[model samples]
Target chain A: MAFGEFDLIETYFTHRLPQRDDVTVGIGDDGAVASVPEKSDLVVVTDTMVQGVHFDQDTPARAIGHKIVAVNLSDLAAMGAEPAWISLALTLPEINDEWLTGFAHGLREICEYYNCQLIGGDTTQGPLSITVTAHGFVPNGKAIRRSGAKPGDWLYVSGTLGDAGLALAARQHRQKLNPDYERRLTERLYFPSARVALGQSLRGIASSAIDVSDGLLADVGHILKASHVGARISVDELPLSLAVTESLSAEQAITYALTSGDDYELLFTVPEAQRGLFDTVTAHSPSKPVCIGRITNEPELVQLRFGDEAWELPEGLAGFEHFRKTELSQ
Target chain B: MAFGEFDLIETYFTHRLPQRDDVTVGIGDDGAVASVPEKSDLVVVTDTMVQGVHFDQDTPARAIGHKIVAVNLSDLAAMGAEPAWISLALTLPEINDEWLTGFAHGLREICEYYNCQLIGGDTTQGPLSITVTAHGFVPNGKAIRRSGAKPGDWLYVSGTLGDAGLALAARQHRQKLNPDYERRLTERLYFPSARVALGQSLRGIASSAIDVSDGLLADVGHILKASHVGARISVDELPLSLAVTESLSAEQAITYALTSGDDYELLFTVPEAQRGLFDTVTAHSPSKPVCIGRITNEPELVQLRFGDEAWELPEGLAGFEHFRKTELSQ
Candidate 1:
C-alpha cells in the first residue's frame, strides 16, 4: 500500500534510529532541538546522495544508508570534530516497508557504533535521495583545516587507498579473487570507516587535514591550493596492502591510490618538528599514519618523483571533479 | 570548458552569497562552524524541494531559490529561532549559468535580509532538487513547541490564510483579476513572510505553536497530537480579507482558511492569564494575532462550529498529504 509522507516518517524513521539525551526534541516536531555541550563549537555538514548519481537502484538499501551516513561522518572526522547529532532529509519514490526497515536498521547500527544521535529530519515524496546534515563538536581552535600546512610540513595518509576504487571497477565483473582479499576490497567499498578517532587524536598535532572523498591527488590538491604550497609525492612511497597489490599491478594500484575516490581515509600534514612523534602516536593507535610526501615552498605545482626519474604533473591538483568528467576512461 | 567542482565553487558560490559574523567557518571546508551565543540553543530545520513535485519547470529560478530558503526559515520561525546560517545541497540537471546566477541572487537577497550566512554546501549533478538545512539560535528553554498547550489554552493565528491556495488554483487560468487582490494572493503564494518576529515575541507567552504550512486544520492538528488536547474553532471567526470574501463564497473561504497550505503564518495558543497581553504584543506588529478557538480536555477530537451547527473534524489533521488528495480540486 502507498503511504503518506507523515506515515512513512513514522514507520521508517521516528523511533527506529538511535536517540541521545542531547536531543531535547526529536521527530514529529517542527524542528529538532539539540544541546551542544559548553565550551565546544558545533560543526555542521550536509551531503546529498541522489539516485543514479550517488547510487543505482540495484544497490542494497542497507549499503546505501550506510555509505551515505558514513560519507557525511567522514567530513566531520576530517575537521577533527566528534560526531554528535544528525538530521536526515529523505525523499523516496515510494514507501517500501522492507526497504525502509533495512535502511533504518543500517542507519541505526552505524549511529550506535559511532555514538551519533539521530535528532530530527523530514521525509517527503520525490526521487530517491538522502540528505544528511550532521553536527559535530570540536574544542575551540582545535579543528583542523586545509590551509595550515607549511612548506616543511610532512604529508601523511591513513590506511591503504584505491581498494574501494578497484572494487567499484570490478563490482559488476566476475573477477577471481582470494576470499580474504575479496572481502577486504568489498568492505572498503560498502563499509568504509570514517577515521574519527585518528582524526580527533591529530587535532592539535596535524597542521593541515582533509578526508579522501575525491581521489588523493585531487583532494590533496585542495590543500595545496588553500595552503599556497607545492607538493612532491613519490609513487613508490604510496601505501598499498597485499590485497591491493595482488589485485592490481603496481602502476594501476598507484593510479588508484592517487586518483580513486571514496576512500574516506584521513590525509593530513604534520610539521617536520613533529615528525618524530609519528611512531609514538601510532604505537597507541590501531592504525598507523603513513608519510607520503613533503610540502614545498614553490607555488602551484604538484610533481611526482621516482629516484632518477621525475615527471611534471597537473598544477596544484588532486581529486575527481563532480561535473567535469563523465568517466575515468584513461 | 570543463570546470572542476572546486573551481566552479570558487567561481560561483564562494563570495557570491551573503556572510555574517556568526559563521565561524564558511564554505570551502569539511564542514561549516557557527557560534551559538551564550545562554542560547541552536535551532535547526531542513526542507527539500524536488523539481517535478514541489515546483514546475517553468517556475522562475529566483522564486524557487526564495521558496526553498523561505520554507526552512518558516520552520525556524515556528520554533522562535533567529535565522543564522544555511547549508545548501543543490542537485541539478546541468550547470546552467543563467539559472545558477538567478538562483544565487535570489538566495543572497533573503540571506542578507535575514542576516544568515551561506556556509558550506555541496553541488552535484542529478535531477533538479535543492535541499536546504537552516540553523538558528533561540534563548535556552524559550523555543515554543507544539506540546505545551493545555485544556484552557486559547488558539490564535496571525494574518489571513488561503490566499496561497487560491493563487495556485488560478495560476494557470490567469482569468481577469482584481489587480489589488491578485497582488495580495500572489504574494501569499510567491513571497510568504515567516512570522519570525511574532513567534519570537510569543516564546514565553505561547502555550503551543506551529507554522501554517500544510493548512490551519492540519498544522494545528499537529499541536493537538503533541499536546494531547482537542480544539473547537469557529468557522465564522476565521480572519478573511474583503478580496477573499468577494472572490469566493463564505463557505469556500472558510474551507480554504482551514485547509489551504503554504500560508506560512503562525498558529499558537495562549493561556487565559495572557489574554490581556495580546493587545499589547500585537499593537506594534504588522499582523494581529486573532483568537479563534480554545483547547478542550477531550482526547482526540477537533470540532468546528458555525452559528448553531457543529461538525466533527478529523483529529490531528492538516492539509495536503503527499499521497492524499490534492487541495487544488477542492
Candidate 2:
C-alpha cells in the first residue's frame, strides 16, 4: 500500500520516541504544549538542511538526519541550555520507506542521547529538506550569550577542529588520506557531537560561548562583533585531530582548522577569576578543553600569532558563504 | 553587491521587527532565549509552505509570508494559546530583494497585529520554501485539545467556510466567479485570519477544538477520531459565505465546503452544560459562532444530515492528501 503523508508520520515519527515529562501534549494535537520549569528561561533555535546544498546524495540518510538535529542542539549547547524538546518540519520529494526509516533512526538516536523529545512536527510532500526547531531550557539569567565575553577572558574550544572539513575534502577528492583516517574523519563529519554537557558545565564559569559551525575564525568574529571586543589567537595552540594533522601539511591543516565549517565544537571564554573553576569542571569532561586564545582590549581586531611571531591566514582561504559558489561551503 | 546569507538576513530580517518584552535574547544569537510565564505552558506549532506544492507563482510573496505565519498561528489558536514568538527557517531558490521586502512586510503586519515577535531563524540557499515554528502561551491545564469532547456536545464553527476553496477553484479556472465575489473569495484565500481572540475566549468552555484547514469533513473527522466519538453534521447548517453561495450551486458549494482545504476557521465543541455560558461569552465575540452539529455515542462514525434526510458525500470528492495525486490536494 502506498503511504500517504499521515501514514508515513504514524509509521515513523508519531510513536516509539523518547517521551519527556514536561511535554503536556505531544503529537496528534493542533500544537504541542510543554511546561517550562519556574525560574527557567526557554531557549529556541532552528536550522534547515537542504538536500543538494547541505548534503549530497553521497551523505547517508541517517547522517543527514543526525546532522540536522546535531546542528540545532549545538546551538542550544552554545547557549548553555539543557536540551528539551524539538519540532521537525520535514519536506520530501517522495516517500521512500528505507530512507524514512534510516532518517527516523538517526533522529531518534540523537534525541534519546540528549534526553530530548520529539514533541510535534509537520511532514509534507516537497523537496527533500528538513528543518528542525529545537527548544532547551536554562535557569533564569544564566543562559550564555555571545556578547558576554570580557576583554580579559581566556578563550577555549571543546574537542578538535577541522576533521569534519578534512572529511569533506577527502569526499570531494580535494585531499587524500589513509583508509583508517578516512573512516575516522568521515565518522566525525557524519556524527558530529554537540558539547551539551560541557556547555552546561560552563554556565557559571564561561564568560561567553558559541558553537563552531561557521569555521573558527568566522564564529569568533561573531563573538567579537557581539561583545564589542577583540582576541589574539595562538595558531600553534589550535587543537587538531590526528586525522587532520596526519592527512594534511602544517599550513593546510591550520588553514582547515581556521576556515572549515561544520565542526560542532563549543568555542568559549573563561575569565581570569573563573579559570580555576573552569579547569576543575573541564577536568572531568570526556573531551579536554584547550585554551587557544584570550580576549583582548583591542576592539574588533583579531590578531594571530605562532609562538612569538605574528602570523597571517594563508591567501585564498575564505569563510563559508551559503549563497556564493564556494568550494567548501555547506 | 551580491547578497550572502548573512548579508541577506541582516538586510531584510534582522531589524525592524516586533520586539517582545519576554524575549531575553533575540536574533543575532545562536539561539533565542525567552521567559515563559511561570503559570503558563508553552505552545508550539510548525508549518511549512513549499513552492509548486503549497503555492504557485501567481500567489503573491506577501500572501505566502502572511499565510505561513497565519497557518501556524491557527494551530496555536485551536489549542487556546496566545501567540508569542516565531522562528523561521526560510530556504530560498534565490535572493530577490523585492520578494523579500514584500514577504517581510506581510510577516511583520501579522506579527505586529498578533503581538508576536520574530525571534532567531535560519536562512539557507535552496528551493523556495518557508517553514515557520510558532510559539505561544496558555495557562496551565487550560489548553483545549481535540480529544476532550464528550458525547452530546454541541459542535460549533467560527465564521463562514468554503470561500477559500471556491477562490482556489476560481483561480484554477475550474469554475468562474463574478468579479466582486472573485475579489472577496481570493482575499479570503490569501489573507485568512486565524481566530486568535475567539480561541482564547474558548479557554474554559470548549471541550474540543480544531482548526478547519483540511475542509469541514476532514477536520471534523480529526476531532472525532481524537475524541473517540462519532459526530452528526447538519449539512444544512454548514456556514457558507455569500461569495461561495452565490458563485456555485447549492450542492457544489456544500461539496467545496466539505472537501476543500485552507479555510483556517475554528471547529470546536461545547458540552451540553456549557451551552448557556458559551452563548453568553460568544455574544461579545467579533465573529458569530454557528452551531453545525453534535457529538454522538457511536464510535468513529460520521453521519451527515440534510434537514432530516441522510446525506452522503458526492462522488470524486476526496480530502486533501499531501502525498497522493488528488486533484485538490495541497
Candidate 3:
C-alpha cells in the first residue's frame, strides 16, 4: 500500500500501546486531553535524537526508538516524578515498513514498562529524527531540584558508568576490545535504562539529584552551579562496569566514567542526617548505589582525589556538544 | 566564539521571554516543573515543521518560528483549552546569528501575546526542523471533542478560508495573483492566529470542533468519522476572502476553500437549542463566526449544496498529505 501519513500512524502508532484511563483523547484529535492527579505538579521534559548526529546506520531502529523515550523519561526521573504520558513529534526521511515496525515495537516496550501512554503527536516527512516530550507527575512541593544540595551532603551515583562510552570508543576505532566485553558494552550503549524507581525513593532522602547524561563531572558541575556548593569526588570510587574496566586500562576506564555521556544513571546527594534513612530506603532498590563524593562549602570548586592524593582531569576530556565541531562520541 | 548547544540555548532561548508563576522550574534543568490549576484537564499537542517539506527558502525564519507555535496553539484552541506552556525541540543545520535572532523574536512575540511561557526544550544539530509540544488547560469534562456532534447541530466556522491556500497556489505558479492580494494572502499563510477566546466561548456550546489544518473537507471527515454522523455544507456560503475571490475563478476559489489546508480556523458544530446562546457568547469574540452548514443524520456521508442543487466535489481535488507524493499546497 502507498502509505499516507495518517495511514502510517494508524498502522504502526495508534494501537497496541499502553493505555491510561486519565487520557480523555489520544492520537486522532488535534490535541490529547488527560486528567492530572489533584495536588500533583506536572514535570515536562523534551529531548530530540537526530540521525547522523545522535546515531548512525549501524544503530538498530529499535534502539533509536528506545533511547529517545529513555532519555526524556530520565529527565523526569531526575525530578522524582512518575512517568505518565508522552507526545512524540516524529520526522522521517521516508516511510519504511520494517523500520517503522521495529521502532514502534521498541517504543511500545519502554512505554509499557514505564506504564506511560502515548497521548498525541505529529508525524512529518523530513530527515530521520524523533522528538519526544514526556509528562510526569510529582506531588506538589516534593520534586527534587538540583539547587537543593548543601555542604556536607554525601554524593552518590547509581549503576556503573563508562560502559556506553567504552562501547562508543570501540565503535570509533579509538580502542580495541574483547568480543565478550564489546557485546556487553554495545548493549550498554544501546539499551541504557533510566533509574526511575531509585530516583523516586531518594526524593526525601537525597538533598539534590540529577541524571548522569552529560558525563559524571559535567552533570555534577550543573548541580554544583545550581546549589552554589563545591564537590570532592573520590576518583577511585567511580563506578565502572566489568565490560568497561576489563576492556581498557584502569585510568582509561576512570576517564570514561568521568567524561562520557549517555549513561542514564542518577547522581545524587544525601545529607549526613539522612544517611541512615537513605541507606535503609535504598536497601531493596534496583541497584546498590555507591557513594563517590561529598558536597563542600567552597562554591564551584570540584576537587578530585585518587586515594589520598589530589588528581588532575585528563587533558582534552570532552563530552557531547551538539553545535560544537568537536564531540567526544557520536 | 565557539557556539555549543548550551551557549546557543543560553544566549538565544533562555531569557527575555514571558515568565510564569506556575513554572517552578524552567530552562537549564533536566525538565520543567509546573502546577496546573485545580479542577482542570491538561491538553497536550505537538507539531513539527520541516524546512524543505513545510516551507521553502523564500520563507522567513521569523515566519517559520511563528507558524510552528501558532499551529500547535491552534490545536489547543480547537479543544477549547487555554495555552499555558510550550517546549521546543529545534534542530538546525547550522548556527546563524541573524536567523536565530529573528526566529527567537518571532517565537517570543506569539508566546508573549498568548501569555504562555517557554518552559523546556532541546536544541540539536541536524537538518532544519522544529517541533513544538504545547500544554494547555480546560475545566474538567468541558473540553470540546470531535466525537459529540449530533444530527441537528449547526456547523460553524470562525473566519474566512482559502487565503493561505491562495498564497501557496500563487507561489507554485498555478495561478496568477495581484501584488496586493499576494502580500495579504502571504500574511495569512505565515501569521495565522488561533481563535482562543472564540473556542473558549464554545465550551458548552459547540458539540464538536476541529481546526482546518488538513483542509476543511478532510478535517470535517475526521469529525464525521469520530462522531458517526454527517454534514451538509453550502458551497456558496463558505466564507472566502476578497483576495481569494479576486485572484482565482469562482470554481478555483471554492476548490481552495474546500480542499486546501494550513488555514487555522475553528470548524465546529452547535446544537439547535444553543444557537442563540452561542451567538450571545461569541458576540465579543475576536472574529465573527459564520454558520455555513448543518449536521446530518446519515452516517459518514457529507453532502454539498450550491443553492438548491447538489454539488459534486471537484475532480482530483487533494489536500495536504505528509507522506503522499501528491500534495495540494505547501
Candidate 4:
C-alpha cells in the first residue's frame, strides 16, 4: 500500500524521535516550539548533505541520518550551546519503507543520547539530500566565537586530527593501510562524536574557539583572520593517535595533521592567567587538550617550529571550500 | 576576483535581506536568534526545490529564490502563524555573483513585506537546489489545523484558482491566450501570495483549514481524511478570473479550477455561527472569500454540484506527488 504525505509523517516522523520537555510543540503542527531560558540565546545551524557530494549512493541510510545531525550538532558545540531541538528536510528519489525505518532509528538514537527533540521538518521528492537545522542555547554573550584571541594566548586542540581524512582516503582506495588501521580510520570518518559537554564547560573560559571541520591549519587560519592575529605552532605537539602513527610515516602523519579535514574536534585558546584552570579541565577529559601553539602580535602570518628550526607557513592557505575546486582533482 | 566563503556571505547575504526587531541575532554566528512573544508557539516549515525536479535550468534565479521561501511561508499561513524568521540552505553548481545578487533581492522583497528576518544559513556546492525553513509563531492552541472540522461546518475558498493551470498549459504550448491574459496567468503561477493575514484572522474562526497548493479537489481531500468527514462543493461557486474563463473552454476551466496547483489560497471550514464574520474580513482583503461547500456526515467521499447535477469526484485527485509517475509523457 502506498502512503500519502500525511500518513508518512504520522507513522514515521511524529513521536518517533526522542522528546524533550523544552520542546513546547513538536511534529504534526505547522512548526515546533522550543524554549530559550532567560538570559540565554539560541544557537542554530543548518547543514545539507547531497548524495554524491557528501556520501556515496550506496552508503547506508542510518549512517546518512547520523552524519547529517552530527555535523550540525558539531557547529552548536563549537558555539558552546546546549542542543535542544532539530528539524529535518529530507528529499528522496522515492519513499522506501525500509530506508525510512533505518534512517528514523538512527536519528532517534542520536536525539535520545543528546537530549534533543526531532520537532518538525518537510519531506519531498527529488535527488536524495538531507538538510538538518539544529538549535542550541547558551548564556547571553557566553557563546564562543572565532574572534578574541590576543597575543600570548595559548592555542589548544582536543583529541587528534586527520583521522577522518585518512578514513576517506582508505575508503576510496586511494591509499593502502593495515586492515585494523583502515577500520579505525573509517569508523572515525563515519561517526564523529560532537563535543557538546566539553564546549559547554569551556563557556566563559576559552578566549576563542572553533570546530575542526576543515584542516587544522586552515581552520586556525580562520581564527587568525577573525581575531587579527597570527600564531606559531609546535610541530611535535600535534596529537596523533597510535593507530594513525603506526599506519603512516611521521612525515605523512604531520602532513595529514596540518592539511586533512573532518575531525570535528574543538580547537580553542586560553589566556595565560587561566593556565591552571586549563590544566584542571584537561586532566579530567578523556583525551587531554594539547597546547599546540601561541598567539602572536604579528598579523596574517603563521609560523611552524620544529625544535630550533622555524619555517613560515604559506600565505593564502587553502581549506575545504564547500563549493570551490581543490588540489585533489578528478 | 573569486571570493571566499566569508567574503561571499558579507557581500551578498548580510545586509541585502530584510531587517526586523524580532531578530535578536541576524547572521555571522553559529545560529541566529529571533524572539517569540510570550504565550506563543513557534511554527516551522521547511521545503526544498531541486533543479530538474522543481524547476528548469533556464528558470531565473530570482524566481527560484522567491518560490523556495514562498512555498514554506504558505505552510505557515495554513496554520495561521505569523511569519518571523527564516534560514536558507543553498546548494549551487558554482558561486556566481550575479545569480546570487538576483536571488537575494527576490528573497529580501518577500521578507520585507512579511516582516521576517533572514537569519543564518549554509551554502555548499552541488547540483543547484535551495531549501528554506520558515518560522512563525501563534498563540497556544489557536492555530487552525487539518483535523478540526465538524459535520455541519461551512466550507469556503479564497481568490481564483485556475490561472496557474492555464499558465502551465500555455508553457507547454497546449493552449495559447492573449498576451495580457498570459501575463496574469504566469504571474499567478510564479508568484502566488500566501494568505497569512486571512489565515491569522481565521485562527479561532476556522475549525479546519489548509492552503491550496495541491488542486482544490486533492487538497480538500486532505481535509476530509484528517477531519474524518466528507464535503459537498459547488462547481460554479469556484472563483475563476475572466482571464482564465476566456483562455479555456468552460469544461476545461472547471477541470483546471478543480485540479490546478500553485494557488496559495486558503480552503477552510467554519461553523455556522462564524459565517457572518467572513463578510467583515473579506471586505478588508484584496480578493474576497466565497463560500463554496459544506462539510458532510459521510466519510471519505467528496461530491461536487453543478446547478441541478451532482457527481462523485474520482478517487485519485490531482496534485503534485513526490513519488508518483510524471505527467510529462502525457
Looking at model 2, the pairs that clash are: none
Which candidate do you rate higher for TM-score, 2 or 4? 2
lDDT of 2 at B296: 97
Q: How much native contact recovery, as a fraction, does model 2 achieve? A: 0.76
Candidate 3 structure lDDT: 0.87
- In candidate 1 chain A, where is summed lDDT lowest over 10 consecutive residues? A321-330
Displacement of residue A180 (Cα, Å) in model 1 is: 5.8
Task: Give me candidate 2's TM-score against the actual structure.
Answer: 0.96
Clashing residue pair totals per candidate (backbone < 3 A): 5, 0, 0, 3
Q: Which of the two, 1 or 2, has more lDDT?
A: 2
Superposed by TM-score, candidate 2 places the C-alpha of residue B46 at a distance from the truth, in angstroms, of 0.5
- Better candidate number, 3 or 4, judged by TM-score: 3
For each candidate, the alpha-carbon lDDT, in order, equals: 0.79, 0.87, 0.87, 0.78
Tell me the tens digit of each residue's lDDT in model 4 across A1-330.
Answer: 112445566777766567787676577554565566666776778888887877886767887778888888888988888998888888777878888887877777788789888888877677777889988888877878888899999999988987987877777887667677777777778777788888887788888888888778877888888789999999778999877788788767777788777788888889999888878876788756899999997885788886668843334433333323342111
Q: Which ten residues in a row have the lowest lDDT in candidate 2 chain B?
A: B321-330
lDDT of 2 by residue, A33-147 (tens): 9999888999999999998888898788899888899999999999999999999889987778789899998998998899889988888778888999999999999999999
On residues B14-120, what C-alpha lDDT tens digit does candidate 4 reach at each position?
78567777666567655675566667766777777887766677667787777778888888988889988888888876778779888888787788789777787
What i-RMS does each candidate reach, in Å?
A: 5.2, 4.7, 4.8, 5.6
Q: Write the per-residue lDDT of candidate 3 for residues A1-330, one digit (tens) a residue.
A: 112556667788878898899998888887899988988899999999998888888889899889999998898999999999999888887878789898998899999999999998888888898999999999898889999999999999999998888788789899888778888889878888988898788878888999998789888988998999999999999988888777888888888898788989999999999999999999987677999999999997888899999987566553232322353111
Best by TM-score: 2
Sort by TM-score, best first: 2, 3, 1, 4
In the range B1-330, model 1's lDDT, one tens digit per residue, is: 112455556666676567777677888888887678888888888888888777778878887778888888999989988988988888877878889887877787787788888787777777788888999888888888999999999999998888887777677673334466887787678777878788888878888899998888878888988899999888788888766777887777787788878888999999999877866887888878788899998854688898668943344343334324442111
The sequence of per-residue lDDT tens digits that candidate 1 reaches over residues A174-285 is 4444456887887888888888888888888899899998878878888998899989887788888787788777766777788878888999999978766766776676
